[model samples]
Every structure is written in C-alpha cells, then in structure tokens.
Target: MAGDKAVSTVSKPVMRGLLNSSIKRNLTVALTLAAISGVAFKQLVGNERKRKYAEFYRNYDAEKEFEEMRKKGLFQSC
Candidate 1:
C-alpha cells in the first residue's frame, strides 16, 4: 500500500507538468496566428484603398473629358 501511494504521488506531478506544457504550446500558436492575421488584414485594407483611389481619378478625368466635349459643341447643351 505504501509503494502504491508513492507511485501515485510521483505520477500526479508528472501529469500536471505535461498539462502545463501543452497549454503553453497552444497559447504560443494562437498568438502567432493572430499576429499573422492582423498583418494580412492591414495589407488587404491598403490595397483596397489604393484601388479605390485609382478608380476615383479615372472617373474624375472622364468628367473633364465631357466638359471639353461640351466646349467643342459635340452635343448641344439642354
């Protein structure tokens, strides 16, 4: 009975250590993934803003072209 008790005590600490190690590893992976996702999201937002700016300038130039057309009497104004 005494030998069994000693073995059980030793096993308990070993089990606890294993559990702690597993938890630490999982937390490290989660933090790494979160950082990677944040960086990717920032890049996507930057690219989207650049595309929108380009589109806005294209539309603005088209309007200027129309004004020039009006000046040239390409179509009669209402």
Candidate 2:
C-alpha cells in the first residue's frame, strides 16, 4: 500500500522572477537618485568657502586702547 502514493517535484519560477525584478527596480532607483543628487550638488549647491574670524584680532590696536584705558583710570589695579 505504501508504493501507491504519487510524488511530484516543486519548481520556484515565481521566486526567481520576483527576485530578478526586485533587483532591477532597486538598482534603477538608486542610480536615478545618485544622478539627480550629483547634478544638484554640481549646479545648484555651488562652492564652499572657509574663513577665519580670529584674523580680525590682527587689526586691533591693543597698546593704544590700553594707554587710553589707563589714562581714563578704567583699570582698578593700574
């Protein structure tokens, strides 16, 4: 009686199709986004500039200001 049972093979064509389409869709979306962001960065975002505000200290008159403050008796220990 055990020899009367029928056996069938299982095929996975649906899974293969789904995985192939998903990879293609994801790759296309990523490439499109990267291209758009690259164009925006190069054309719309422009260049970057870095400057130091501490350089303003080089233009200060420290000795003259100190002499004026001393003459005006602005320093308590002077």
Candidate 3:
C-alpha cells in the first residue's frame, strides 16, 4: 500500500537516527526514565493504599475489641 510505504519511509529516518546516535547513552537515558516513572507509579499506588488503610483504621477501636475478646475468654490470663 502507498500509505504503508509512506509510513515506513517516514519512520526510517527516525530509526536510522537512533541507530546512528550514541545508542548506549540513549538506552541509558530511556532506562533511567523508565525506572524513575516505575518508582513514581509504585510510590503513588503505595501511598494511595496506605491512605486507604489509614482511613479505614481511623475509627477502629482496638482496646474495645481486645476487651471484648478477653470477656469471651479468647485469651488466657497472663
């Protein structure tokens, strides 16, 4: 197809430039960017999960629950 040929021709120069350039440096930059973005994405997700857990536990009554468990004889006297 003419369109396919045109697209390939357009891309050839770009690909050729990448191949002719400092490939190691380009790869390093790309890898560094990927690592940074990955870390940022992980941190974002982790922070969101932490916030959700914190919000969920904000109204939790740990002492009351423990007392109830003790009253139920769930734990031995220590």
Candidate 4:
C-alpha cells in the first residue's frame, strides 16, 4: 500500500507539470501569432496609404496637363 501511494504521488506531480508546460507553450505560440498579425496589418495599411498618395499625384498631374492644353487651345471649347 505504501509503495502504491508513493507511485501515485509521483505521477500526480508529473502530470501537473506536463499540464503547466503545455499551457505555457500554447500561450507563447498565441502571443507570437498575434504579434505577427499586427505587423502584417501595419504593413498593409502603409502600402494602401502609399497607393492612395500615388494615385492622387497621378490624377493631379493629369488635371494640370489638361488645363495647360486648354489654355493653348489644343481642345476647342464647345
């Protein structure tokens, strides 16, 4: 009976330790994923902003050229 009690006690602590380690490992993985996702989101937002600025400049230049052509009478005003 004493031997059986000693075995059970040892096994309980080992099981608890395994459970704790598993929890810690899972938490670490979750945090790493969250950080990666945040960085990706930030990069996407920066790219979108750059795209918008480029489009704005392109449109602005086209409008300026159109005005200059109008002043030069290239396009007849109807």
Candidate 5:
C-alpha cells in the first residue's frame, strides 16, 4: 500500500512536468504564428492602401482641380 502511494505521488509530479512543458511549447508556437500573421496582414494592408492611392491619382489633374477650387472661391489669393 505504501509503495503504491509513493508511485502515485511521484507519477503525479512527473505528469505535471510533462504537461507543463508541452503547454509551454504549444504557447510559443501559437504566439509565433500570431506574430507572423500580424506582420503579414500589416504588409498586405499597406500594399493595398498604396495601390488604392495610386489608382486614385492615376488620372488626376491637380492643377485643374486647383483652378476649379479657385473658381468656386474655395481658395483665397494674396
């Protein structure tokens, strides 16, 4: 009976240690994947914004718009 009790007690700690190590490894992998995905998402968003900006200005006429704004009295000239 005492021998069985000792074995049970030792096994509990050993099992706990194994579980803790496994959990730590899994947590590390999860965090690493999350970080990589976050960076990838950021890059994708940045590239998309850049594409949209270029598309918007692809045929834009800045001087013509400025003249229109002046005609509309939206700009004051000194």
Candidate 6:
C-alpha cells in the first residue's frame, strides 16, 4: 500500500476559476434585472402621479380652495 496514492480530479485553481466565473455571471444578471426593475418602478410611479394630479384637479378651483383655507384661519395676518 505504500505505492498507493490518492489524487483529486479537480484542483484548487480550477475550482476557484469556476467559482469566480459563476459569481460574475450571477452578479451581472442580478444587476441587470435590478436596473430594469428600478426603471419600470419609476415609470409606474410617474404614471400614478399623473393620474393623481388629474383626480385632484377634476373638481378643483384654486380660488375656492384658497377661500376655504382662509376661512380655516390657515393664513398668517401679515
């Protein structure tokens, strides 16, 4: 048994290279998806803001709103 020896099929350097490649691929995918999601979310938020503005102005009169605020004593007496 003195002449018998064991050897690994894969070495440390090869394993490290494979691991690095995998990490790089996953990182690239994650970053790409994150960026796309962020852009999509911003678009959704912008559309929602426009909708809300339209809703607010549907029955809005600036003069009436100001008059109501004045009635509530919201303005300073300057």
C-alpha lDDT score of every prediction, in listed order: 0.84, 0.77, 0.84, 0.84, 0.86, 0.86
lDDT of 2 by residue, 1-78 (tens): 655566656775676579889999999999999999998776654432112334556667899899999999999999
Q: Is 1 or 2 the stronger prediction by TM-score?
A: 1
Worst 10 residues of 5 by lDDT: 7-16
Instruction: Please state every model's RMSD to the true fold in angstroms.
Output: 7.6, 11.7, 8.8, 7.7, 5.5, 5.2
lDDT of 4 at 45: 92
| Per-candidate count of clashing residue pairs (backbone under 3 Å) | 0, 0, 0, 0, 0, 0
Model 2 clash pairs?
A: none
Give the per-residue lDDT digits (tens) of candidate 1, residues 17-52.
Answer: 798899899999999999999989879997889889
Model 6 CA lDDT for position 59: 77
Residue 61, model 3, lDDT: 94
Q: Residues 1-78, candidate 5, lDDT per residue (tens digit)?
A: 768866644344566479889999999999999999999987999789998999989989999898888889986771
* Stretches > 4 Å off in candidate 4: 1-13, 50-78
Global fold similarity of model 3 (TM-score): 0.47
lDDT of 6: 0.86
Of models 2 and 3, which has the larger TM-score?
Answer: 3
Candidate 4 global lDDT: 0.84
lDDT per residue, candidate 6, 1-78, as tens digits?
644556436555666479889999999999999999999987899788988999999978999988999999999981
Clashing pairs in 3: none
The CA lDDT at 60 in model 6 is: 89
lDDT of 3 by residue, 1-78 (tens): 768866643344465567657788888999999999999987999889999999979988999989999989999882
lDDT of 2 at 13: 67
**Could you tell which candidate, 2 or 4, scores higher by TM-score?**
4
Each candidate structure's TM-score, on Cα atoms with residue i matched to residue i, is: 0.43, 0.39, 0.47, 0.43, 0.56, 0.56
